[model samples]
Target: MSHSPVHPQLRLYFENPVGRLLEHPDGYLVVQYNAGKRKLEELKTFLTQASTLLQQRNWHKLLGDQRVMAAFTEAERVWITENWLTRSTTAHPYYGAVLLAHDVFARLAMNLVMNEARESGLVYRLFEDENAAVAWLLQVP
Candidate 1:
């Protein structure tokens, strides 16, 4: 596995090429991926910023909107599950609801994340629709 230093701009959270790190009024953050496959470095930066936002906002949950997300490589999945997702596992416990798009590759990656999250004791659910995902996340802490 290999990783490069992500662009500094990705650290900004709210505005980035891959997605926007948004806070919802209802509580929790939204990591909405853009309409293209993101490089491993970009995803890493997104997660790094996301982790910071999670801690800063004292939020325990997140909503992942994958409507425009692109396929993640096998190595990327491993990195995310072992490095990123494991790091995301907090003592307070994080909850997440990931909305899967029609993209098969994207769904597969989401499933990988979902499985890894469950193993790491994070409460998470996969959704085929946004409304249901929001509903699930609303019930989380």
Candidate 2:
């Protein structure tokens, strides 16, 4: 996504080659992935940072804007599921509102990961718009 002006209510947390991680005033993490492929190391770093932030704040909601993100490689997917998601879910049954990627391959990759997340007890929903995703996240108690 373009690094357009950030919403006044959002706090820019971290911006890496992979994405921009923001903190919403209402208490959640907002990760807007850039429109490009990500190296495995970069992806791992970004997720580790996000998880750290989540644990520090005890936040349970995340808005993942993956509309322009490229597809994840098999290795990346495995690391995410085995390393990041498991750690995050064990800490809290977090709620995630994901805006699906425009690329069909990216969407498919995300779906596979999300399905695993569901089985792990995460409550999540997919959306095609940011407003709807944010609204759904806010409504989640």
Candidate 3:
């Protein structure tokens, strides 16, 4: 989908079949994914694009909204754990938010993954609301 300018310095768009990215006024990047059981190639392509953008812009904040990633095959979970979560450390955004809203099992799983991601030196939070997510991303030091 096309990216629309949401604010003077913010851009928002759907990155792929299952994810959206919001680049914010203060150099923050938010990437949201919801594709379940998607192929590893697809996830890599999508995340690679996002990583390129993040590197190009040097965004200070990154939000990953996986609220819709409700279920996953075993392979999918392993891919996410090994690829997405770990690879996030390479880009190194100052803040990261993993959004969750439904599916108790998925929420719990993501929470654990996020905790591990936090050890990589990025501030991370989990939220169930878009407003809260935005607030966390925009929070000033």
- lDDT head-to-head 1 vs 2, winner: 2
Residue pairs with backbone overlap in model 2: none
Q: Which pairs of residues collide in candidate 1?
A: none
Whole-model Cα lDDT of every candidate shown, in order: 0.76, 0.87, 0.66
Task: Show the lowest summed lDDT stretch of 10 residues, model 3.
Answer: 1-10
Question: How do the residues 5-92 of candidate 1 rate in per-residue lDDT, one tens digit apiece?
Answer: 2334333357566677877767688887777666788778887888888999889888877776787779778888888778876788
The alpha-carbon root-mean-square deviation between model 3 and the true structure, to one decimal in Å, is 3.8
lDDT for 68 in candidate 1 is: 65
lDDT tens digits, residue span 1-141, model 3: 222224566576446665667676667677766645566677678777776777788765776666666555456556666776666675445577667746777777766666666775557787777778878777844
Q: What lDDT is reached at residue 89 by model 3?
A: 71
Per-model TM-score on C-alpha atoms: 0.84, 0.94, 0.72
Q: Which portions of model 1 show Cα errors greater than 4 Å?
A: 1-13
Tens-digit lDDT track for model 2 on 26-129? Answer: 99999889988788998899999898888888899999988888998899999988988788656458899998988999999999998888877688799987
